[model samples]
Target chain A: MSRLSINQQTVKQLSLPELIRACTAVGVDAVGLWREPVAEYGLVRSAELFTSAGFSVTSLCRGGFFTAADPADRRRAIQDNRAAIDETAALGAPVLVLVAGGLPAGSRDLRGARAQVVDAIAELAPYAAERGVRLAIEPLHPMFTSDRCVVSTLAQSLDIAEQFPVAQVGVCVDTYHLWWDPDLDAGISRAGERIAAYQLADWTTPLPAGVLTGRGQIGDGCVDFPAFTEAVLATGYTGPIEVEIFNDELWKRDGAAVVAEIAARYPACVGTAS
Target chain B: MSRLSINQQTVKQLSLPELIRACTAVGVDAVGLWREPVAEYGLVRSAELFTSAGFSVTSLCRGGFFTAADPADRRRAIQDNRAAIDETAALGAPVLVLVAGGLPAGSRDLRGARAQVVDAIAELAPYAAERGVRLAIEPLHPMFTSDRCVVSTLAQSLDIAEQFPVAQVGVCVDTYHLWWDPDLDAGISRAGERIAAYQLADWTTPLPAGVLTGRGQIGDGCVDFPAFTEAVLATGYTGPIEVEIFNDELWKRDGAAVVAEIAARYPACVGTAS
Candidate 1:
């Protein structure tokens, strides 16, 4: 119960104040937040508000999109990421999640795009570390490879993280994005202490358009939460297990009700595996 | 030009006679057939129709789904796969593409399901080899990993293929599925003589529901066809290069027109990468 955190996107319909209130109602003391809504709520105010409300910021949603080939575009992306890192620091979030951007328009060089990700991270990692924030490389599912992320496997994320200082860079483990991997257990074992943040969203079928917003609730899909939780826990990870869903169906429901449901499912589906 | 094979699903709107005429009109002498359509057109008749039309059958559509946990269900799958292998032989298709089944209902054992695929293939490989038909394990995109094939990488498919006699088993290299993989080059190089069938499809986004029919037309998406062709060709794979799109828009168009577009795009996007 203490380890469960609800990422704001799971109840996207709620405003920051609404979310905080809902969490208070449901006895959720922690949450993961996205950049857009956090900014909308006034960053410093939200940070102060969460602290006063007794909520821990598990992670900050994003800080990457470094695949642009154009130098100017790349510079803009880097600047934006630096701002994100600063926001993460200000919000008392130790981890800033990164979604490596998709292929630039008309680009065929996936290798080139991936190289760009490495270079950008190299620039940002030091800044993030100085500010006491860790950059979490979140490998989206392969369906998003061309349009969202080149980092599709946990092993690949670990490969990037290993090149940097262990304290500064790490990878996000999300069941929704990685449940399909056969080499997952090995990758998780290898990730060990480099595990920055742990998230859960089940793999549901008939994926909707854009393949985004179709994530299932914890118990509604095929992912074995116990096995994943056990693997991450085996790595000595005592961090929060964030419930991060992007389902349109869940978003339309009452935010408090959704949080309550998540609180219930966390125990039943993700059981304490230690 | 001589190596191009249009899989039936690419132009699924066309009947057997219509597809034959469409190919003849465009000077296409090779095709990949699907089991359902072939059965619909009569197995013996499809074989006769194709042979008399001077069309080489590059590969038969499918023959796997061995993840069922029940003994009775497993036996039925084995029987069905045997029939598919027989159909491959009858059609003069040297390869039978196998889409390994997803998790059995309510099961979280992805490793176990994958093992089932290998075991079923082991059972079917000798039978396929006897008939001069090679089993080609087709690892679907990770997006299909749950409801379709648990085998999500060419490397994983190759891992399974390596277990059997080279003459009896191999893998289908599909551009759409394998393009996202960073280790694809290594997988293709390792495949070498075991590359039974080479397939092409682009990775367009904003994927529709079910994700079954959203495959892109050859040059319509992000796949680098030349890179894939060069790698496969470098493996000494001289088999027909199949264009297998599952696009909804393409299916709605005149089938002959779609084939003509594929023929044009094959040269432009795929090129003669010898």
Candidate 2:
């Protein structure tokens, strides 16, 4: 059976220890942890619990929020990312997903925001490489360009990755963010081995308030899962499929039920190995 | 004074006659017509109303929803576009805005959807060329990619336009739809003289239920209007600045009031001409 990873963001209602217990109880092969929860449980303690429970830590929730108005703010973001890298290494997570932050507060210059992101990533790349954890820049949907992320296109993400010589900087392809791109196939082919993590979620209409947290569950929206998964697989990424949803409604449901739904949805995204 | 063009879709609440009266009362210099309204008013009568009121027809509302499951359906779309072309000539609009339709009814194949769009445009381009009306393929926001239009990027729109001679096919650069593209400069520069129309509107959060009708008035959202206008101007486009908003809330207010707001908002988007 293909491995199933439950992203902590999908079940923020639970404590890190509770999330670990939930993962084990739900037949989840892995659990993806976010920084706050891990810090709350203490990274060492959380890692031990997962290892003891036979749950692999697929990936660290996130490490990038790079765009900032001032050089000092930018430096602070990089420093925080450095700590996140350390946390990922301690937790035994191979990858730390990077979400390029949007336009700096009150800034309308998208070009300037993008430049800050590149600079921040470049600064953190070396430190992350030294820590033995890869940084995967996740390109959010274009709608989030203003307040969430400026890197709205896969080509844009690949362009940023191309800037760094070391392969430590790669891309995290999340279905909800990228199913709309016209050049997706070409982008997947170009990414090839530079794909660090493959995350799945669905895109739906009537997106909720706090747009960041409205992601749909797999098979809950219009995205063609089988096709999207096949394209990413064509890039030769055989890593564990991580189910990441940010639905407010889902968080209110029973954690075990949500985990079961994700487990069922995981195979729909990627075909089950016979 | 800078020219103000009214797109009918923005004031979809009013009948064609009332819409023209609203425009004339507000001193709107131009108006964009749609097929249903024109057909409802009859082409000759619709042409006479605009002609008598001395309003320049900036562009036709739309003509492309090309992706279809069957060849017959595709043929029907082409024929409908021909009728739209005829109506554009009747109303004296120099440009016809084309929105490439979304995925074929049940199909989730994005690439295939785009290929169908190109073929439909190729088929319709020749007819529009002969009719003296330029086809302006408007690239919609990615949020609408599933149910509205498949051409989600300016680069993709221009790439399609490049397939034909400059005069026959072009793209409409609508600020509300394309304000978030990372490559806005390069895309606008590539559009250059092939830009058939330059439309304006703002992007707002808590988007309306009918996604197609939720555009904000200029200066109301996160879009950098001065920069957006400057980018279009840098492309050497000296066309009429069309203000189009599909807000149901705005439409519920007096059409004249809405027109006045657009007139007031226009200067903010494109500062007073020197």
Candidate 3:
């Protein structure tokens, strides 16, 4: 194993400090911490705990929700993202994950909402660059187009990234969000070394409620992990394959058991050793 | 008013004969008949009723569930599509819509299933072309990728059609299926004159169960209809904008009233009047 990073979303059931302790106990290599969890543990204490355990914060979970009808709220969102970048920097995380906001209230114009995303990102990029924080735009599934994200395709994400200089802008290629894309290969090729994060999860059929929470664990469903991993590696992404499952069933299980199960399954799905 | 077609699916609650009478009462210009409706009304009587009511048969409501594991069943699917072509010919529909089948049962290889779809279409395209019936591949919503069709992208559908020698083998650009595509403009441009149908409906948030039947009526949700209509027209598709909503709410209404509502809403969402 090169290194294992458990996305905090996988063990969302655990507190941030508890999640860190759990990762250390399992001899895990890294953590992808979310905002709410950090707030719960208090950012200062959370940083102290990670530092004490010598844990690496691979990335911070989220700093974008840019669509807004009001300019004041939009500006506030940017400020919030800047703070998120500062927190990520303080925690020694390399990238700040961004879940671009859904449509403005009562707005049916996705293109218009998408424009807001572009403009917001363009404005945020320079500030993020100054802070030495890479803004990794994660393309959510198309089903989220109406209410979660306007950037539904990786190509679109890359296109959006092109507007800003490559130094501080890239994408988080989460398989849960992108497994169904027909242009996935081309998108990954275009992404190349610019892919800041390589997240993995299986896509279960008959999506439940078609929301953010129905994600499956690696090898539990249809994603060709070996093939997709090969494609990502071909693009020179040698990062840890971050396992980030959002299974409700798994959430209900014992956190330690889930972590062990994931640890066991990880190498089988992505390892060269058969 | 060029030619109004009542897709049998629009009034799924009513019997085929009842739907026919309702279409007649509402002064519909034509009928897009479904297989089940045809079976109920008897193909002979369905033809008789359309002829008597002076309604043109615009298209047949589907004939392709092509991806199958068994070679015999695959062959049977072709034969069934041939029958649909014959029924289309009998009822005088210029086009026979094809909803290509999805991942085969107990299979996770979508790529293999898609290859099967390409081969199946290649075989059936020739027969439909010879019979003077246009075979229109409807690129379904990505949400239907698991069990409905492997051809989820408009670009993919156009790629498949490019294999056939004739222009008659084309695509059906349904708004509900395609509105989320970031490469929509490029796909529409490629479709050009090869687009056989332009179906319209809005995409609602938190889609209902039996999602096949949960589509919203035109102008009822978030799709930019006028913009989409303009793009399709830009591709040289000046065909009738078929308003094809599969909503339970619309189905519960009187068939005549539903037709009236569509008639009132469509022109607004379509191209600007000269």
Top TM-score hit? 1
Question: Candidate 2 docking: what grade?
Answer: medium
Q: What tens digits encode model 1's per-residue C-alpha lDDT throughout B1-274?
A: 7888999999999999899999888789899999999999999999999999989999998989899879799989999999999999999999999999998988888988998998899999999999999999999999998888999998899899999889899999999899999888998999898899999999898899889898999888889988889999999988888989898999899999999888877787766684
At residue A47, candidate 1 shows an lDDT of 98
Candidate 1 residue runs with Cα over 4 Å from true position: none
Backbone clash pairs for candidate 2 read none
Query: For residues A48-164, what per-residue lDDT tens digits would candidate 1 score against the true structure?
Result: 999998899999989999999799999999999999999999999999999999999889899999999999999999999999999999999998999899999999999999999
lDDT of 1 at A54: 86
lDDT of 2 by residue, A1-274 (tens): 3467888899888876678677767676687889898888777888898888777898997887888888898888888999999999998999999988877776777888888888888888888888888989899998788777889988899999988853688899999999998788899999888898988888876666446777888887878888877888887788877889999899999887888777766676666431
Identify the runs in model 3 with alpha carbons over 4 angstroms from their true place.
A271-274, B271-274
Model 3 chain A: worst 10 consecutive residues (lDDT sum): A205-214
lDDT of 2: 0.83
For model 1, the local distance difference test gives: 0.92
Q: After superposition, how far is residue B36 of candidate 3 from its true place, in Å?
A: 1.6
lDDT of 2 at A249: 90
Instruction: Looking at model 1, give its docking quality level.
Output: high
Best by lDDT: 1
User: DockQ of each candidate's interface versus the true one?
Assistant: 0.84, 0.50, 0.52
Candidate 1 at residue A110, lDDT? 96
The candidate, 1 or 3, that scores higher on TM-score is 1
lDDT tens string, model 2, B1-274?
3467888888788887777777777677688777887888788988888788777889888899999989999999999999998888878888899999988766777888999999989898889889898999999999889888999989999999999988889899999899998788889988899998988888776554446666787777778888787888887787777877888788788877777777767777676431
